[model samples]
Target chain A: MVPTNIKNFDTLVVGGGIAGLQAALDLGDQGYKVAIVEKDASIGGKMIRLSKVFPTLDCASCITTPKMSAASHHENITLFTYCDLTSLNHEGQGIKALITQKPRYVDPIKCIGCRQCEYICPVHVSDAEQGDFSARKAISIPFSTAIPQLPILDVEHCMLCGQCEKTCPTHAIDYFQKPEEFIIQAKTAVITTGFDLLPVKNNFQYGNGHIPNVIDSMQMERILAPHGPYNRVLRPSDGMEPDSIAYVQCAGSRDKSMGVPYCSRVCCMYAIKQAMLLSGSLPLADIIIYYMDIRAFGKGYEQFYQNAKAMGIEFVKAKVARIDKGENGSAIVRYENQDGSGIATADHDLVVLSMGMIPGWDPRSICPVSKDSDQFITSIKPKISPVLTNMAGLFVAGVAAGPKDIVDTITESGSAAMEAAKFMSNSHMEN
Target chain B: MKNPDNDKEKEAKKAAMKTLRAQRKDLIASASSRMKTQKKDIKAIKEFLKGKKATIPDIAEGIDMPKDETLWYIATMKKYGQIVEAEKEGAFFNYSLNEPEKTQEKEEV
Candidate 1:
């Protein structure tokens, strides 16, 4: 028999990114009880980490934070941050999900977001929230705008230090905290799990992340952010303001050797956006983008590309073959100019690779959702409704279905929510 | 006067902490060693910038550390308010140790 302690909800949203937040808010505002299970401690996901969106140059946080706040503050929504979905299966007319809440080592109820423990902690480690470009206390909130505003203790580096314990006003520190498991029974489910970048270490042609000043697109975003590690655009290798910068497009995409054959649709535009931001910040610097093809297919995208070109940003139609370390913390780009120039090598103060995107989660063993050739969730009726998955009452949206931009992800999220609501309504009618 | 049950609970907690520390002895020792090395490196950089602002490459050469590693330490220090960015020198910005009074003010906050 099913446990009586199971929490019942009308809809369950997985992954708490912008897509998940949108779906949850859409259903919750309709008066349906919605539950959001996020793997990370925060719900803003990759969109929040970005500096600005493409074409509009609007602040990414400005657009994402309000949605995140709405989802968190919504009366019908329940947020399960820092959770792992053990299994999600069809149960009777509803879906049953087993979830494990990871230990924060700090009591959620007792934590007042005072940050007293963080201030007192002496151990400093690489802050992954800042792309490891800065330091954070052994116990710290993930970032300044983390939704929960609770600090997580890094047990590996904690050293059993009692400073935080002594300093915490609420006595929230608990060294013996263990993972808690729970179950959620919902009438419908939506998968909005986003994408992760292809690891730089896997591509040997790009120096396997060994060459300094050769960073990925996300790291460049953090550098461009207002509250970034350096608060300025300086190369990580030597803290130098680069006089010349280069962007290598299709670094991992369209390459069968990397097991990612599809073009990551966002890389070209993002590289151009970063180049424009860099040009604005460093007016005297030379910015070059090496690309086989520039895919500006979105609305106002072509005009954005033209604007970048008019802003003195050079677009070189070339295929970057490899990158090597250069003198004084520089990167040498070796590429074949598509203009019939045989081969050439150029040394740049910094090089940013527009890495490909891969599926963020694998639902094979956990959930029996079918995946397409690219490993994204397969949409059964893509032409009619791209949100409909093979499993009944299980809809997929955003990059979880395929590679898409923020605008498309948001639009698809709403569609998924509508489909889920319709499924629940039909199920109720049949009952 | 403390209750007997409370005293017993306190003893049990202390014993448990002792066992936990013993289990994590190796990790603690290694982390401590790393912290010590990091402190020494930061000290070397601070000493190099005692009375003068220096660029990352200049300090790396001065302290005989790799440029990349030196930059990491410098960036961390700058974030924690130990150092401040100075005037731009060519392609690099010179960094200097924060004033003693200013560091104390930051600590107080």
Candidate 2:
């Protein structure tokens, strides 16, 4: 049986990624009570996992950590991590959200955030947070810098070793923990649900992710991250420092067969951004980007793309058709060079697929919100007010509305918060 | 925080732990077995590539293991500095043992 607890807030921000965090912070600063519901154990979201943001190439953590810390420490904001929203519907003048907080097994209050229990655990599992290039203990915190500093015991992989229980200073390890149901009431809501990269498994042209050296952009981000698994750029197939790397643009987006016809907007720039970073790390290695079009459509973005070329990064005008396993463990890229070279094939030590972005959440069954043809939450008045959703008192922001970069996502989040705040104040006046 | 009534809750937790331990014996054993096999695979792959450069498929066929599974082992070996990347042939890059820099020779592709 799940215990139900009721709470009230001025605004509810779904998805605790960058956009949600920014929205919550903006409302919280204005003295409005806000609730941030995150599906993961930590609150940093996808931005925290990123190595660096494009254009500036600044450390992503340096920018996101302070915001995460502020949100966690804010008086008006409460974080509900590792939770699932069962239903969200309009209740009278407010919104009622049914949330199920999945058990962490370890009591949040009693646990000291010490990693002693993790060290004693025997089971080892692939750490997806690190792009699965490394292993982590089954009973451990998501990362060293994970907000809330809580450890989650992976019940599926845990062997019920009493080692963690015995090692804990405070008997916080509770194996029988169950989910708790909670009801949150908010005058308005902001859907900042983020975007997810298209899966590489079913794409037959990309060798079905079987060619070991062929990785996705997210994996490339991990490889470039300072605190990443290996802490350096190395091919996953055999840990060899790659001498030549290729980026396949439009690999997952703008395809009729895969059902994603949109450009995904950010792939081209990110590919170039990563190529530049790779140049810094592997000075002698040849970095090439196979792109149909280089869309540097942001402030200082065109120059950033040109800067990469100046740094000797090659941008080949080609559409990658298929990837095959090469003789020695390299990835063979087959493509047609758009520069009048009918058909071409190239071998590179590693290939990174710039997969397109897809809407992170589908709210068909959960809420009354409608999605656009591209599957992102529909914003009825995108030109007049981009944050206004079709439903009243509900706003959508960031990539949840459409694919965008971090800069645009953060700006959109502020707009959403302001709109939500105004909606709540107007409702208060009417009452 | 310690009280006489708290003893009951502690006892319940102990019983739960004991039952869980009993149920998870096979899980623990299997985990150890998987680790052992992974270690053996890493060793075998390193030995096979001791003085030769080979692609993932070549190593997979040589070690009599599936291509997908062999990739994992080869990645682990590379992570630990047992292997280094060689030149690209056709579509794949050949991998060779990580030898001293002085003895290394650039392979002409």
Candidate 3:
């Protein structure tokens, strides 16, 4: 239900990802009332799923959780997770937004994340926590370290057995719970919805999106991660010991022949990181990487790449022409060698693609105001400012603004916050 | 006691910025002094930074330049051995005039 008080917030941030969280934090720190509306059950967004960020080599949760916790706990910021903006009406003074907070069937304020309901939950579902490499209890925290510590019931898989509802310590579970709709009043809104990974084709000749051995770059990160499914590297298809791995760069980027033509900036280093981490797992495992160019331009990133090569990770300087699933469950990679000699094939037990960033929003919607060829929001003006978008009160940051490293993303996000606040201040003064 | 490291960081950032602006100023001045360096260019920046050496980012407040047509013009100069890359100290890059002999290329051109 819409709050009867209808508190007039100074700014409303949509999407609740890193960009929105940073924007809200900056505004809130300036003593402005801010609201972050998140479609997910919690914030952190895509960054949460990442194993580790580049350059600094920090854990994703270590860097992001503080911001998430701050956003949730801030007195000046109200976090509405599991929510989406349904409708928006301009109030002349500000925007009147209707938000739908989908019921997790758990009262957020009272329920401590004690995991009582999960123990009794009868249903089993794919654990998005494990990147769907494993299953999880229906009533479960998104992960062990999720901010707000609230659990979400997998409503689709739930049988409404009501066993979990009966067992809750705080009586927080309610199967009949309806989505609470509310109106938010804010002078400006920012979209920080974050991004989704592209689906790999089943027909990929590379070991497998189809075969167990072929993994996406994200999955490789997870496997190499200390927190990933199976602390040891195990080929899921047969659970047999497989030796070799190959990383194919520009899996879906910079190829107009396919849909995406722009470079995925994060892929080069991430592939290297994955390769290095994989080497740590199998000291004897032969690792090979194929690429257009090793763009390790970020600070310390070049060092990381060199470290990988020094650790015996084979760096093949060639664009992979194709992959053929070979006999004995191995895959063959055919590519021209660096010296442009005769093309040769190399066999591998697994293949990993270094996929690039793709925006979640359709191009036609957020265009003209912030349009560009790469589908990211163009900076407000070409050279004057780097973070501001065309929309007066709104700003873009991170990959949403344009391709950038993690430090650049945060830096731009901070600048966007200042720009948004200045826009608010000037508008308020004008009013 | 003052944190000398912080002070040095602030100083380096300013110097790098000054060097960059001075180079850009040369670009705009070369293009058309009558048009005036747009608020966004390096020449306007040097004028803005006159006498102030160590300004914090919060303190470095002024309107930025609008575009880089003049800056791009200098990029052509870079290709033809006119402009050169200065030492990269940290986050910022510094640019400066070479020796008088190199600067005299404009006279011949």
Would you estimate the TM-scores of all the predictions? 0.96, 0.87, 0.74
Candidate 1, clashing residue pairs? none
* Model 2: DockQ score: 0.13
| Candidate with the greatest TM-score versus the true structure | 1
Q: Which ten residues in a row have the lowest lDDT in candidate 2 chain A?
A: A230-239
Superposed model 2: Cα runs more than 4 Å off: A1-3, B1-11, B18-109
Most DockQ-accurate candidate: 1
Scanning candidate 1 chain A in windows of ten residues, the lowest lDDT window is A1-10
Full candidate order by DockQ, most accurate first: 1, 2, 3
Q: What lDDT would each prediction earn against the true structure?
A: 0.91, 0.86, 0.67
* Two-chain DockQ for each candidate model: 0.66, 0.13, 0.01
Model 1 lDDT tens row, A84-110: 999999989889999988989999999
lDDT accuracy of residue A169 in candidate 1: 89
Can you rank all candidates by lDDT, best first? 1, 2, 3
